[model samples]
Target chain A: MADTQLEADVTVNAVGSSCPGPLMELVGNAKDVDPGTVIRLQSSNEGTEPDVAEWSEESGNELLDVVDRGDHWDLYVRIDD
Target chain B: MTANRPSVLVLGAGAGGTMTANALRRRLDADVTVIDKGRTHRYQPAYYLIPFDYMELADQERDTRELLHDEVSFVEDEVTGIDPDDRRVEGEADSYEYDVLITAVGNDRRPDAVPGMLEGWNRTDSVYPFYHASAAAALGDAVDEFDGGRFLVTVPDTPIKCGGAPLKLTMLMEEHIRKRGLRDDAELVMTKPGAEVFGTGPKAPYQERIEEIWDERDITFVPEFTVSEVDYEEQVVRSAEGDSLEYDLYAPVPPQYGHEFVVENSPLTDGGEYVSVDDNTLQHETYPEVFALGDNADVPTSRTASAARKQSHVVVDNVERYLDGRSPAPDYDGYTACPILTEEGKAMIAEFDYEDSISAPIVSRLNWFLDVNVIPSLYWNVWMRGYDPVP
Candidate 1:
């Protein structure tokens, strides 16, 4: 999937936050949104990528794509029902 | 020897062990004994400031015998193995038996774990692993003499004690360079194996504040750059990802791991490097009589002295309950505090528990004073003496 093609239902700006911060924010927002809701998490912390991927797998959510934006990362996740 | 008076054996007279032993001595009628190889107990928190000559090694050093309560027995022996099944710990000098065991033998520094790191420290003038006392003192001289070029600090990809220490050291070095009128000539750089500078979870506020501070100071932060080797002869550090950076001076936090006795000899760790304890109760999963705290415990939190201080309280309470034939309480919430010194007189107290951040992420002189001036004194007088009113 292309980075610019998909539109997120919710966006979490977690830039300048580290490890569990981005992941925590993602989890927090993911809980409030609907099951099929697509969320975009932008984070500068490098660990967030793997953490989000692991969380998605463990939580049974769909990780759409991970985009490198030079300075930060954009991770798209579809919440599971 | 009697059912009424149980004997407690504590391992390693470090922060957690010392505090727990002293507290247990006062609270319970049980006979408490602490076994450690070292005669001197060094205040490890002051290691970061030693490079800047903020605190002396002598001032931080105290005899192990002096720290413990008079009623508590102090055994000077190097632990060779631990037999949880037999309720015994084998030391180099002799084997000791115990009714209850608390393992707090903190992690070991292994510069040799990384290729060329140990060689770099020995052979080159530039390489200084500042976690060690001698290296910290030597870095002071190196810092004094350094005029220009890249002043780099690297954190190893390990769950290190005081996770915020590398960040504090990096920022302090940047400030030092600026103060010496070498900011324009020298490049300040810090590398971590992970993406963040300080950490994540409830540390978002502090991490954000640190990012802003680093940006204003022009201190470069390199993420996911795990140091593979230090080419001391060429004055360059190569990362596992094939990236290399040349430096004029380097202070690297050495790779740390649990002692072989705990991980290899004892079944307490349950095949992990550290003593595998319940994060909340701090009791060994398989052995109810076994408890672990401090850097040695596999707690999902920053392994700071502050965390150990808090854990000490819970461990003491749980041990008391255990002696009274009660179930251990889940008291420890993974609470830890890191006083991040942004500059000489400025710091931010990043305090947090398992789920959330508790302290405001505000940099101030008061916080700096609390960390540098008050904490050390309190550590020696109150906390070490087992008179922790705060806990």
Candidate 2:
């Protein structure tokens, strides 16, 4: 069943964060949270939209709330079970 | 009572648009109106890593309203047509006339420009363009499913925002798979249209650095090739040189060209269709009151934000000067900069202009940190605010 419940959430500032840096932040934060946690990451990578979605889905995590703020991004990823 | 500041109009809210808006807001006393079809702004340079599932989409945007000074007028509307004869811009819902117009409407990636691109993009994981937001994310998904095969990255036959981006993706992706213990399982390949990594001038140090990294990594480099079509079914990508590569995951950078709308409508555009403006002054070739900056204009240099920043100053000065009936001689030298990330925590800062290359940093952890850390802060707190200095 799809875990309909979103438990905890946090936001990361990936302003100039590109590539490996943003991924490092995501992986590092995901480790600290319990299962079913959704961390909302905001980035300015104009290229982040499809990238975050693909990553979350590929890793078997739920990705949601992807928005473009012109120069930055807001994305939500649910921690896997 | 009047200091002779020209009433300026700027279109679009991308890097060039914002730079012109902020720079003019600070320099000229004239009323400035910035028109953007959308309210959200995405810092495009940061998108290179989305395919690795490295960054979140939310981190890429900011409110256009927040980035502006209180004096700069922000109008959210899509332009329908430009009436250069009468100095007017027609939008979907409204029309506005201006004494001086700054055309900074950045180009969008028209996937339809290529044959079968949209369908091939939606259908397959073997091919993608990193420059697009969705393509980068899709690339990330493809990488996750990648069990181990040839990983191909191709550059199209055209000018793009950042010339170093494709190479950067190759480096970062290599690092990602290596960390995952799949280095031996996957083969990394680079296909580009340029004869060398960066074909621009002042190229010794940067070229040597890129050549060094090309050899150090197992990444294969195929130069002077253009991707003609995508055979998604067979998972093979064909190039102009008649070479085909079958891949498990393919990331291709699309060829960039001038914005068709302005080029087609305006007689000021060159035959190939880019806004023709003074290289130094950034003023229109025919209309003194009209100016352009960034990717849309026919500036003979690498189309990067760095070039835009320098040009923004000249645009502001000339606008003010044109109104004052004074000569505006603020000349831009076509300087562009991109800190090429050779790898995680290792970057070769390549800063160059139409003539000279400025960034030749000694290899160190500091340079890498600048690309990954410091530049982000600069882009946000400084450059985006119109304070990016000229070197």
Candidate 3:
């Protein structure tokens, strides 16, 4: 269950990051990236699943995939066109 | 398990109340009505971070409505008192009847408990108390303008939400001054009503480590000092024990007491404040149908959110058992944890029960990671949302 096959345009390593940190980073970087770009976010926080999903949908982005990486998680989101 | 759906009424949408209400929702198949004073549910531990600019004030609060399960009925009103004999609770707009009542109306912050504390709180830039978010934000500005002189942090004798907060803020201030290159310009001093820097229990090992930090940093530790009044004009703080200290910048931990509803209405209170409950079961000592937890309950332990976490489990279990026609178990052992942030990146986890048995690695970055990263996220998404693993 790896999202590595998608070849993310930008890899955001938020492994050590906390709650709003991971989500805020994604939102900030999502604005800079071109549309149709896939950004991979890594977060160790347990709230990442629902928080990231809600943020992606609310911001009109597509959550492509979520891969649990044991202690952390890899959430892939694509910028909305 | 009973014939009719049990009616559960809870007061205060805080850690203990929210957790107990949600946990009961999972097992009891009951109609739960929650009475909260406001719509905002605050993440209080984050208050400590606001002054240091580690977190924003807005991020510390959430809609209390969203924290509860959909099945639970929410009431937004001010609670006046509880008529325990009638098994009814008096609220501002309406009254509620309950089969089981849980009062989690935690400690109320009384800045005026000590004379002159609130009078000069925001009026002067040199004096600030960071116990609440509004005050914490004000303290942030004060910390910015304060470049030197004695930075005094004092705690009143009354029970506080988090006993470690005063020390944590003191430590954070020391780090902030040093980081801003004002270390030599400022002298750090911490005065508390208690004789020990930490409490007199399993906190010894951690206290020893803290004392070492204070020694190395040249921070003065004043014990057995109860701040009675603050002379804002002269920037002097007088203690009840007839001692005084001068400071250019002061951060005081305000005295905290139970909600007036618990104190004025029911026989559940002792000393005219603080709900009296069975220390282990968390049930009201006099009224069997009523229960209490969080800072509001007089449990004879350090008043911290961590203690409430453990107490929540016992309350939930005992409440369920009580409904099932069984005696409540004395399960709560006063388990309390404080993830004391030593610095921005490093911290320590102080965990102990009633027996005063200390846990391991008194200080580490691991605990800091849990506090800063994992705990808040879990608290928001899981615990408060009725998804806690316990029970």
Candidate 4:
């Protein structure tokens, strides 16, 4: 399934946030969610993709995919077991 | 004898001072206090957007009391001078003693630095400066009423906060005039003291591209011209090298220097009238317990907020290491970034360091979005809040 189409266990709304905001929100909220749960993160910041990509990799979270939504983006991250 | 907590006194609650104070509060058990002349804290980069009427002065300002961490004590008083030997700052009302002193009072516009710069400033509507809010707003009004004649934008002979501001203003005004149907009547002239528009640094390519753009846009570039006097009555700009230009609207960027109080009182200042610190460590060369950052530090680079952000990290780390009783290893490499707004929605991100290499000018709406959207939010929420998560 497309990342944007994936059923998310938790939706992290980072809309209207800037660089590192989406990433910081994800980092802060990821611990509350259970393992194997896919977290949906949305952001409009241009510097978000690379930051989230690197963060997910470094934190052992599985990044499902990043989808461009014109004005913003939807990033899916699956928490690691 | 009563035991007093080791204290850190930060001078000038600007970007560098605020960030340093907040970061140190988290890392140390010391009492962190920040002192400034006023309670107003500004996201100065937003000043550039004002003249174009994209933002208002209120949008760029936040009270320093609210922006600073609650744990960090905030003092709103004018600093008269610092007695380096006594490790105390004499303020207008009271004196503050510190175990460690960090001076972050950035260089501010000195209209009097040049002969005619201050004399003619704001005396007439024909001459305006866009570096400050009031002046920027006035300049905006002037630009709006300008029907025709020469619109001259000038750069200072000294280093400035944003190297891209003068060019950005010229470019934006060109588009504004064109949109208002006055392009043919108004001639846009960019005058700089240097032979080159931008220094022969990593910004060369971007400068070259700008040259091309200006040429195609019918904007004239006058190089190696310094404004020595502005004959506000006669509407003439005179350069020290005996060159002169007549203009209906003159936007001058006067030379900037360190805070008068800090420069005159503290022996930490260099010949440039800024704090003399190690390029990397940001620690004062003569006094190890004293450090400086931001535009006030004589670091042989353009004074920029981006440079201050980078320097903040290094200064915080070294300060922590110093308190831990270790020799400081300087790690700052003069990294700075300037988001050059080309038109309304397009900008180029110019990122480079002390090394004469630059990231090729990346011009796009996305970059503009970062400046108009991302950077400001990050500055207030992440950096100032003392949570610089990004290294």
- Candidate 4 has an lDDT of 0.79
Expressed as tens digits, the lDDT of each residue in B123-227 for candidate 1 is 557887777765776677788889999999999998888888888888888888888998899998999988898878888998999999999989999998999
- Screening candidate 1 with a backbone cut-off below 3 angstroms (N, C-alpha, C), the clashing residue pairs are A20-B201, A21-B201
Candidate 3 at residue B387, lDDT?
65
What iRMS does model 3 reach? 15.5
| Tens digit of per-residue lDDT, candidate 2, span A42-64 | 66555666766675675677776
Model 2 alpha-carbon drift over 4 Å, by segment: A1-81, B1-6, B389-391
TM-score of 3: 0.81
| Every candidate's lDDT | 0.86, 0.73, 0.80, 0.79
Model 3 ranges with Cα > 4 A deviation: A1-81, B1-3
Sort the predicted structures by lDDT, highest score first. Answer: 1, 3, 4, 2
Model 4 lDDT tens row, B311-351: 98888888888877898877988898888888889898887
TM-score of chain B of 2: 0.93
CAPRI tier of model 1: incorrect
| Tens digits of per-residue lDDT for model 2, B1-391 | 1245556788877888887788788887778889876677777777785665445656777888788778889987767677788888887559888878999886655544556454356444466666766466556666777788888887777767787888888888888888889999988888887688766467567878787777888788888778887777888888778988887877777767665557666565756657889788888888888899988878888888777877877887888788778876948888877778776777777877778878774556787787667776677678778886635
TM-score for candidate 1, residues paired by index: 0.82
Q: Is candidate 1 or candidate 2 better by TM-score?
A: 1
Per model, how much of the real contact set is kept?
0.00, 0.00, 0.00, 0.00
DockQ, each predicted model: 0.01, 0.05, 0.02, 0.01
